[model samples]
Target: MRNNWLIAACCIALPMATGAIAAYVTIQNVQFWYPVLRKPIFTPPNAVFAPVWTILYVLMGISLYLVLREPPSPKRRLALVLFGIQLFFNFWWSILFFRFHSIGIALLDIILLWLFIILMIRQFYRLSNKAANLQWPYLAWVSFASVLNFSIWYLN
Candidate 1:
């Protein structure tokens, strides 16, 4: 049983670590493009993003674990798969926009990522309502990010 707890901690840690790495990737590159184009007048200060993501990634880890604790079934696996898809898209957006500096591709990636979150929410709702509920903020954030991505691509 102690081994199980150890595994659980590692499982939760994986996404959190990935998220921190992703955030660093963002912070280190944010300035790279700041001077290149006109940012939206409403663009929030860079400082806001870190606190927000820290909360979201913790929520994500909890949601993933909640979904995983149930017995094996198609529903459980589907929920996990959808969740994974959204996560991949999340990391990819950072790579596309920050690393490659392709605003158009980043916009495209965000749109798809938004759709993946919606699908994950629906799948998670079927398995555990709380897990589904936990993701709403993440979804909302992604939706907002999608709009921000579009604006960035369009204005620049």
Candidate 2:
């Protein structure tokens, strides 16, 4: 029981900390650079992004925790690998879009991130249905973000 909670905390901490680091890299860009961009008509207010992303990252952490608790197996291993890859791209997107201001490359990165999220969801489902379900919001958010990314790229 103790180990379970500990593992869960660790899993959650990993993603949340990673997200904070990514946010740190983009903090100045979001405050200064992003405001000047040619955004789409449907763009949410600047205040909307932080809370939404925090929730999504928490969901991702829980999903990963569920998967990690599964017994060691090939399926579990693959799921973890896919999760790591998706997480990497998730982190990278912030740097690419916000910090570097590479909207075109960020669009491409988000598409890849979207696909990888789907793949990760599928793999997680094979092991834990709850784990896979947790990723739906993350997937949906990213899908919307993809369009926003493309629109930003097109406008800019």
Clashes of 2: 0
The ten-residue window of minimal lDDT in model 1 covers: 27-36
Which candidate achieves the best lDDT against the true structure? Answer: 2
Predicted model with the maximum TM-score: 2
> Model 2: per-residue lDDT, tens digit, 16-89?
98899999989999999998999999999989888998898888989999998899999999999999999999
Enumerate residue pairs that collide in model 2. Answer: none
lDDT of 2: 0.94
lDDT per residue as tens, model 1, 63-147: 8877888779999999888888888988888878887788899899888988999999899888899889999999888888778
Q: What TM-score goes with each of the models? A: 0.91, 0.98
- Report lDDT (CA) for all predictions: 0.83, 0.94
Give me candidate 2's TM-score against the actual structure: 0.98
- Model 2 Cα displacement at 61 (Å)? 0.9
